[model samples]
Target: MMNILNKILKRYGDIYHPHKQVMESLKINKYLYIVLILIVIEGLLGQYMLYLNKDIWGIIFLLFYGMTIAIGSIFHFKYVEKKFGSLEEFDLEKMNKFVKLVDQEVKIDLTNKEQNQIINQMILEKLERENIKEQKKRAFTGGIFTVLLIPILLPFIIENNQDILILTVIIMLVGIAIIFFSFKSILKDYSLKYKLERISDMLKEILIFSLRDKSL
Candidate 1:
C-alpha cells in the first residue's frame, strides 16, 4: 500500500521545477525584444508613409504587419515544439543509457533516499515543460485560424456604410471568438503544465533509483 501511495504521490510531485521559470523568462524576453523593435520600425515607416500623401499602400502594409504579428506569435509553437522535442528525446536517451549501465551491474550500494528525491524533482520539472509545449502547439493552431479570419473578412467590409456596419459586427464577433479561444488555450496549457510536473517527479525518482543501483 505504501509503495502504491508513493508511486501516486511521486507522479503528482514537482517540488522544484525551475524549468518553468526559465522557459517563461527566456521566451518572454526574447520575443518581446523582437516585437518592440518591430513596432518601433513600423511606427517610423507608418509616419513616413503618411507624409508621402497618405499612401494607401502604407495602410495596406500596416494591415499586413498586424496580420503577420498575429500569425508569427502563434506560429512560434512549431519552433518551440520541435526544439523541445529534440531536447527531450536526447534526455530520454541519456536516461535510458544510465538505466542500462545500472542494470549491467556497475555499482549497487550507492542508492539512497536523498538522491531519489532529487531525481524525482528533475523528472517532474521536465514533464511540466513538455506539457506546456504541447499546449502551446494546440493553442497556436486555434490562434492562427482566429487571426486569419479577420484579415480575410476585413477587405470585403470596406465597401459602403451597410458593409462597414456588417464588417464592424463581424470584427467584433471575431474579437470575441479570439478571446474565447485564447482562454481555452490558456486553460489547456495550465492543465498540461500541472500533469507534466507530476510525471516529471516520478520519472526522476525512477532515474535516481536506476543510477544508484548500477550493480543491478
Candidate 2:
C-alpha cells in the first residue's frame, strides 16, 4: 500500500504541474488547514461581536475580516485558474504538434490504419478527460468562494439575523465538505497527472527523434 505522503504527493502533481514542487515546499496542506481554522475563528468572532458593541472598531474589524477572506479567495481562484489555463495550453500544444506530425507523415505515406485509429482514440480520450478535470477545478474554486461569502455578507450588510446565522452555518458546512471532497478526488485519481506526464514524455521523444533525423 502506498504511504499517505506518497498519495498526497501524487495528488499534488495532478492539481499543480510546473509549480507542484513550489507549492509543496510552501507546505500548502498545512497552510490550508490553518486557513480553514482561521476562517472558523473569524466566523465565531463575527457572531460574538454581533452581541457586543456595534462600535466603529467592531465594524472595522468586521469589514477588514470579510475583505480579507473575500479578497484572498478571489485571488486564490484566479491564481489556480491561471495555472490550470497554462497547463491546458501546454497539453493542447503537445496535441497540436502530434497532429501536425501525423499530417506530415500522411503527406509522405499514410500511417497504418490500426496505428491511426489507436492514436486518434488516445487523443480524444485525453482531451475529454482534461476538459472534465478543468471543469471540476473551476467548479470547486467557485463553489468555495460563493459558499464562504454569501452567508457571511448577508449577515453583515443586512439587519436580519434569524435566517442569516442558519444560512451561515449551512454554508460553512458546505464549504468544508466541498474542500474535503475535492481533496479526496485528487488523491484517489491521478488520471490528469498521468496524462500530463505522458504528454511531456511524448514531446521530449518527438524533439529527440527530430533532432536525430536532422543530424542524419
Candidate 3:
C-alpha cells in the first residue's frame, strides 16, 4: 500500500524536456495526497462513529467527503506548473501512426488528405490492437469478485470488540478502494473502446461509399 501511495504521490523532480512536454499534466498535485490520507482517516472515523451508534456524527463526517474533491481541484490549479517528463505518459501527440510512413508519405502517390486518412486508420488499428476490451473484461471480473467477497468477509468484520471491528473496517476500506478504482478503470477503458468503435464504423462506411463510387 505504501508503494502504491508513493507512486500516486509522485512529485516532479528535475525533468526538463528541452524540447516538448511529452505527457499530460497531473490533474491532482502531490499535496492533495494529504487530503487523500485524511480521506482514509475520515472513512475509519465515520465507520467507528456509526459502530458506536453516533449516527449524526457519522453523517457529518461523510459530508466532509466532498472536501477531497475540493482540495484536489484547488491543488490542481495551484500546482499547474509541472515539469515535462514528470507528467503522465498519456499525451496523444507522442502516440504512433506509422514509423515506415515517416519519410515515404512525403513522396507517396496519395494526397495529403488521403495520407492523413491512412494515418488515422493506422491510429485506430493501433488503439484497438491493444485489446482494451479484454482488459476491461478482466478488470470487471476482478472487481465484481472482490465486491462479492466483501459480503462474505463482512460477517467476520462485524464483531463485539471495538478495536477488532475498527481493524476490520480498515481492511474493508482497502478492499473497497481496490474495487472502486478497478471498476473506474474498466469504465474508462470501455468509454474509449466505444468511441474507437464509432470512429472505426464511420471510417468503414466512408471506405465502402468510396469503393462503390469507383465501381460505378
Order of quality (TM-score): 3, 1, 2
Clashes of each: 9, 0, 0
Q: After the best TM-score superposition of candidate 3, give how far the Cα of residue 128 lies from its true spot, in angstroms.
A: 11
> In model 2, which regions exceed 4 Å deviation?
1-124, 133-166, 186-191, 197-200, 203-207, 210-216
What tens digits encode model 3's per-residue C-alpha lDDT throughout 1-216? Answer: 333212211211112122223222323345655776777888778888999999999877777766765776666555653533432322212221111233243332122347536644664664665476667767776776678767756665675445676666767777787768767866867655554554445345445555666779
* Candidate 1: segments with Cα more than 4 A from true spot: 1-128, 131-147, 195-216
| Tens digits of lDDT, candidate 2, 47-164 | 6777686565566666767876786566555554575575455454444544464455433111234444444345456557766886788687787678776766676557665576
lDDT, each prediction: 0.57, 0.55, 0.52
lDDT-best of 1 and 2: 1
Model 1, 1-216: lDDT tens per residue? 334324443323322235543455356347645664675677667677878967886786677568656765665554555665754553454445444443344332113456455555554655656677766776786777767975778677654556776777777887787778777867866665665464455355565656667757
The runs of at least 3 residues in candidate 3 whose Cα sits more than 4 Å from the true structure, single-residue gaps closed, are 1-28, 81-116, 122-216
